[model samples]
Target: MALLEVKNLGISFGGLRAVNNFNIQIQEGELYGLIGPNGAGKTTLFNLLTGVYKPGEGSIFLDGKNITSYKTIDVNKAGIARTFQNIRLFKQLSVLDNVKVGLHNQYHYSTLEGIFRLPRYFQIEKQMNEKAMELLKVFNLDGYSHYKASNLPYGQQRKLEIARALATNPKLLLLDEPAAGMNPNETAELMETIQFVQKEFHMTILLIEHDMKLVAGICEKLTVLNFGEVLISGKTSDVLNDPKVITAYLGE
Candidate 1:
């Protein structure tokens, strides 16, 4: 069964259709790309998948379970986690604390235990600390664990966002423009990081990226969106070479 599936899904904003008749199926461990020009509704699609927006028609399934229109938090708990196109870190929190927030989904103690610093709280806290640090180390952010999340360089901050999302232990990870604002060298590093994350975590990823180079390097399959509709979906090379994509997306 596919890890993620959407069938005939669509949403309209007032009289305008923002996403119309979208359908996609992604297998476990696949790295897929959603690419388009600005306003192609790529992020809107992410919002829908993450439950920020409910679809007006059709169904969404994760691992064969219908999750259409589930509340945002509930959708998150159901094995889907995503990073935003705009970085959304807890700026006031320490880098470690930011990651721990994601870990909260998996490890928890009662509120009383937290308030009183009970033994169970400490136990869970220790486990989360170890795990969060392990994730930070993967992103090479371990040495800055105590620093404020807002203080990291832009590239490291982007990495931290991904690490935190992974801390949710999600079955599917969605990255929205992971290479946005990156330099050529930073984009190169990001490609390696994404590849490493997929292999190390055995993760399934679906990302919305404008950087064709980054998309080409990592995504095996590609979906092109144009003006809120799918232009094409197929093997990366084939989709990139499609005449429709050349005319509508890349421009002849």
Candidate 2:
């Protein structure tokens, strides 16, 4: 069975359809790309998959279980985690603390244990700290573990956001324009980091990005959306060279 599947997925805003008749099936450990011009409903699809927005029609399944009606937190708990187009980090929190926040859901201790500083609380907190540091190391942000998330440079902040999402231990990871606002060097490093994460974690990833170079470098399969509908879905190179996709998106 596919790790993530969406069939006939759609959503509307008032009188306008934002996403229409979308369908995809992602297999285990595959890297997929969803690309299009502005207003192509890319981010809307991410929102629907992550439970930020419920679909008006169609079903979403992860690991063969229906998650169409699941809440946001429940969706995360169901093994899907995502990073946003705009970096969202706790500005005032230390980098380590930010990752630990994602690890919070994994804590087995009760609220009472946490309130009383019981042994279970301390035990779980220590383990989470160790794991969070390990994740930071993967992004080369371990040195900044004690630094405030807001104090890091823009590129590092983006890495921190992805680290936090990884702490959730998701089977499926969705990234929305993860390389946005990055320079060439940073975007290059991010591509390597994403490749490492997928290999190390054995996770399925679907990304919505505008950088054709990055998408071509890493994505095994591609899907193009135009005006809220799919323009094409196939191998990355074929999708990139398709005249229809070029006319509608690449504009050449």
TM-score per candidate, in order? 0.98, 0.97
Write down the TM-score for model 2: 0.97
Q: Candidate 1, residues 1-252: lDDT per residue as tens digits?
A: 999999998999999888998999999999999998899899999999999998999899999999997999999899999999899999999999999999987897999999999999889999999999999999999999999999999999999999999999999999999999999999999999999999999999999998999998889999999988989999999998889988986577
lDDT of each: 0.94, 0.94
Q: lDDT per residue, candidate 2, 193-217, as tens digits?
A: 9999999999789999999899999
Q: After superposing candidate 2, which stretches have Cα over 4 Å from the reference?
A: 250-252
Instruction: Name the TM-score of candidate 1.
Output: 0.98
In model 2, what are the clashing residue pairs, if there are any? Answer: none
Name the candidate that leads on TM-score: 1
